[model samples]
Target: MESEAAIFAGAVFSLFGGGLLVWTATCVHNHRPVAHGVRPVPSATLAGVVAVLALAIGTWCFGRL
Candidate 1:
Protein backbone atom coordinates (compact mmCIF):
# COMPACT_ATOMS: atom_id res chain seq x y z
CA MET A 1 0.00 0.00 0.00
CA GLU A 2 1.11 3.58 -0.67
CA SER A 3 1.95 5.75 2.30
CA GLU A 4 -0.05 8.82 3.20
CA ALA A 5 2.91 11.12 2.75
CA ALA A 6 3.52 9.84 -0.74
CA ILE A 7 -0.11 10.27 -1.67
CA PHE A 8 -0.15 13.80 -0.33
CA ALA A 9 3.03 14.67 -2.15
CA GLY A 10 1.65 13.29 -5.40
CA ALA A 11 -1.50 15.34 -4.99
CA VAL A 12 0.49 18.47 -4.39
CA PHE A 13 2.61 17.78 -7.48
CA SER A 14 -0.43 17.28 -9.66
CA LEU A 15 -2.09 20.42 -8.36
CA PHE A 16 1.00 22.57 -8.80
CA GLY A 17 1.78 21.17 -12.21
CA GLY A 18 -1.73 21.77 -13.48
CA GLY A 19 -1.84 25.22 -11.95
CA LEU A 20 1.50 26.15 -13.45
CA LEU A 21 0.39 25.03 -16.89
CA VAL A 22 -2.72 27.14 -16.64
CA TRP A 23 -0.80 30.14 -15.34
CA THR A 24 1.72 29.94 -18.14
CA ALA A 25 -1.03 29.85 -20.73
CA THR A 26 -2.42 33.14 -19.49
CA CYS A 27 0.93 34.93 -19.45
CA VAL A 28 0.77 35.67 -23.16
CA HIS A 29 0.31 39.24 -24.33
CA ASN A 30 -1.86 39.37 -27.44
CA HIS A 31 -2.10 43.13 -27.66
CA ARG A 32 1.18 44.00 -29.34
CA PRO A 33 3.67 42.66 -31.83
CA VAL A 34 7.37 42.65 -31.10
CA ALA A 35 9.59 44.97 -33.10
CA HIS A 36 12.02 42.18 -33.88
CA GLY A 37 9.24 39.61 -34.30
CA VAL A 38 10.63 37.62 -31.40
CA ARG A 39 8.69 36.34 -28.44
CA PRO A 40 8.44 38.82 -25.58
CA VAL A 41 10.75 38.36 -22.59
CA PRO A 42 8.29 38.41 -19.74
CA SER A 43 6.09 35.63 -21.05
CA ALA A 44 9.07 33.44 -21.86
CA THR A 45 10.56 34.00 -18.45
CA LEU A 46 7.28 33.21 -16.78
CA ALA A 47 6.95 29.95 -18.69
CA GLY A 48 10.52 28.92 -18.00
CA VAL A 49 10.26 29.62 -14.31
CA VAL A 50 6.94 27.85 -14.00
CA ALA A 51 8.18 24.83 -15.97
CA VAL A 52 11.33 24.54 -13.86
CA LEU A 53 9.43 24.82 -10.62
CA ALA A 54 6.92 22.22 -11.72
CA LEU A 55 9.65 19.81 -12.78
CA ALA A 56 11.55 20.26 -9.56
CA ILE A 57 8.45 19.79 -7.45
CA GLY A 58 7.42 16.69 -9.40
CA THR A 59 10.86 15.11 -9.10
CA TRP A 60 11.02 15.72 -5.39
CA CYS A 61 7.52 14.39 -4.87
CA PHE A 62 8.10 11.28 -6.96
CA GLY A 63 11.36 10.58 -5.20
CA ARG A 64 9.52 10.43 -1.90
CA LEU A 65 7.18 7.74 -3.19
Candidate 2:
Protein backbone atom coordinates (compact mmCIF):
# COMPACT_ATOMS: atom_id res chain seq x y z
CA MET A 1 0.00 0.00 0.00
CA GLU A 2 0.99 3.63 -0.33
CA SER A 3 1.07 4.02 3.43
CA GLU A 4 3.40 1.09 3.85
CA ALA A 5 5.64 2.40 1.10
CA ALA A 6 5.70 5.81 2.72
CA ILE A 7 6.58 4.31 6.09
CA PHE A 8 9.38 2.29 4.57
CA ALA A 9 10.74 5.32 2.75
CA GLY A 10 10.60 7.37 5.91
CA ALA A 11 12.40 4.66 7.83
CA VAL A 12 15.17 4.50 5.26
CA PHE A 13 15.61 8.26 5.23
CA SER A 14 15.64 8.43 9.02
CA LEU A 15 18.24 5.73 9.24
CA PHE A 16 20.40 7.47 6.66
CA GLY A 17 20.06 10.81 8.42
CA GLY A 18 20.96 9.25 11.74
CA GLY A 19 24.02 7.65 10.23
CA LEU A 20 25.09 10.95 8.70
CA LEU A 21 24.61 12.72 11.99
CA VAL A 22 26.73 10.17 13.83
CA TRP A 23 29.39 10.27 11.17
CA THR A 24 29.54 14.04 11.25
CA ALA A 25 29.73 14.04 15.02
CA THR A 26 32.53 11.53 14.94
CA CYS A 27 34.40 13.57 12.35
CA VAL A 28 34.03 16.70 14.41
CA HIS A 29 35.13 14.98 17.59
CA ASN A 30 38.16 13.47 15.88
CA HIS A 31 39.14 16.49 13.86
CA ARG A 32 42.87 17.08 13.49
CA PRO A 33 44.77 20.27 12.83
CA VAL A 34 47.02 19.99 9.85
CA ALA A 35 49.63 22.40 8.53
CA HIS A 36 47.13 23.83 6.09
CA GLY A 37 43.86 23.65 8.03
CA VAL A 38 41.73 21.56 10.32
CA ARG A 39 40.65 18.35 8.69
CA PRO A 40 37.80 16.22 9.94
CA VAL A 41 38.47 12.60 9.18
CA PRO A 42 36.47 9.81 10.76
CA SER A 43 38.46 6.74 11.61
CA ALA A 44 37.99 3.51 9.72
CA THR A 45 36.89 1.63 12.82
CA LEU A 46 34.32 4.28 13.61
CA ALA A 47 33.05 4.29 10.05
CA GLY A 48 32.77 0.51 10.07
CA VAL A 49 30.86 0.55 13.32
CA VAL A 50 28.49 3.18 11.97
CA ALA A 51 27.97 1.19 8.79
CA VAL A 52 27.15 -1.97 10.72
CA LEU A 53 24.77 -0.16 13.02
CA ALA A 54 23.03 1.49 10.09
CA LEU A 55 22.70 -1.85 8.31
CA ALA A 56 21.24 -3.43 11.42
CA ILE A 57 18.75 -0.61 11.85
CA GLY A 58 17.74 -0.74 8.19
CA THR A 59 17.25 -4.49 8.37
CA TRP A 60 15.15 -4.20 11.48
CA CYS A 61 13.02 -1.45 9.99
CA PHE A 62 12.41 -3.36 6.76
CA GLY A 63 11.71 -6.56 8.68
CA ARG A 64 8.90 -4.83 10.51
CA LEU A 65 7.11 -4.04 7.27
Candidate 3:
Protein backbone atom coordinates (compact mmCIF):
# COMPACT_ATOMS: atom_id res chain seq x y z
CA MET A 1 0.00 0.00 0.00
CA GLU A 2 1.75 3.12 -1.18
CA SER A 3 1.36 6.03 1.19
CA GLU A 4 0.06 3.84 3.93
CA ALA A 5 0.50 6.55 6.54
CA ALA A 6 -1.52 8.89 4.43
CA ILE A 7 -4.27 6.33 4.09
CA PHE A 8 -4.35 5.73 7.81
CA ALA A 9 -4.33 9.40 8.66
CA GLY A 10 -7.04 10.00 6.12
CA ALA A 11 -9.21 7.31 7.60
CA VAL A 12 -8.69 8.62 11.14
CA PHE A 13 -9.36 12.19 10.12
CA SER A 14 -12.45 11.32 8.19
CA LEU A 15 -13.83 9.30 11.07
CA PHE A 16 -13.05 12.01 13.58
CA GLY A 17 -14.64 14.61 11.36
CA GLY A 18 -17.69 12.46 10.80
CA GLY A 19 -18.05 11.91 14.53
CA LEU A 20 -17.75 15.60 15.28
CA LEU A 21 -20.30 16.41 12.68
CA VAL A 22 -22.70 13.90 14.14
CA TRP A 23 -22.18 15.31 17.62
CA THR A 24 -22.72 18.81 16.34
CA ALA A 25 -25.92 17.76 14.66
CA THR A 26 -27.12 16.23 17.89
CA CYS A 27 -26.11 19.29 19.85
CA VAL A 28 -28.00 21.56 17.46
CA HIS A 29 -31.05 19.36 17.59
CA ASN A 30 -30.98 19.22 21.37
CA HIS A 31 -30.42 22.93 21.66
CA ARG A 32 -33.46 23.84 19.62
CA PRO A 33 -36.13 21.18 19.49
CA VAL A 34 -39.28 22.10 21.41
CA ALA A 35 -37.30 23.83 24.17
CA HIS A 36 -33.79 24.08 25.57
CA GLY A 37 -33.07 21.73 28.43
CA VAL A 38 -29.29 21.41 28.71
CA ARG A 39 -26.36 22.22 26.46
CA PRO A 40 -23.94 19.51 25.45
CA VAL A 41 -20.18 19.67 25.74
CA PRO A 42 -18.38 21.54 22.97
CA SER A 43 -20.71 23.98 21.26
CA ALA A 44 -22.03 23.12 17.84
CA THR A 45 -20.00 25.91 16.25
CA LEU A 46 -16.76 24.68 17.77
CA ALA A 47 -17.46 21.10 16.89
CA GLY A 48 -18.33 22.20 13.36
CA VAL A 49 -15.05 24.05 13.03
CA VAL A 50 -13.05 21.03 14.15
CA ALA A 51 -15.09 18.75 11.97
CA VAL A 52 -14.39 20.87 8.89
CA LEU A 53 -10.69 20.98 9.71
CA ALA A 54 -10.51 17.24 10.19
CA LEU A 55 -12.38 16.62 6.96
CA ALA A 56 -10.09 18.98 5.11
CA ILE A 57 -7.02 17.26 6.51
CA GLY A 58 -8.46 13.91 5.56
CA THR A 59 -9.12 15.09 2.06
CA TRP A 60 -5.56 16.35 1.82
CA CYS A 61 -4.19 13.03 3.02
CA PHE A 62 -6.30 11.11 0.53
CA GLY A 63 -5.16 13.47 -2.20
CA ARG A 64 -1.60 12.40 -1.54
CA LEU A 65 -2.41 9.00 -3.00
Among all candidates shown, the one with the greatest TM-score: 3
The runs of at least 3 residues in candidate 1 whose Cα sits more than 4 Å from the true structure, single-residue gaps closed, are 29-40
> Predicted candidate 1: what Cα RMSD to the true structure?
6.2
Estimate, for each residue in 1-65, the C-alpha lDDT of model 2 and write its tens digit. Answer: 86587568657856785776566566556663211343334344455456667666666666667
Model 3 agreement with the true structure over 1-65: per-residue lDDT tens digits: 77999999999999999988887787677664322343444455666888999999999999999
Q: Of the candidates numbered 2 and 3, which has the greater TM-score value?
A: 3
When 1 and 2 are scored with TM-score, the better candidate is: 2
Alpha carbon deviation, residue 24, candidate 2 (Å): 0.5
lDDT of each: 0.64, 0.59, 0.80
Q: In model 1, which residue pairs have backbone atoms overlapping below 3 Å?
A: none
Candidate 3 global TM-score: 0.77
Best by lDDT: 3
- Deviation from native of the Cα of residue 51 in model 1, angstroms: 4.0
TM-score of each: 0.48, 0.48, 0.77
> Could you tell me how far off, in angstroms, the CA of residue 41 lies in candidate 3 after the best superposition?
11
The residue pairs that clash in candidate 2, if any, are none
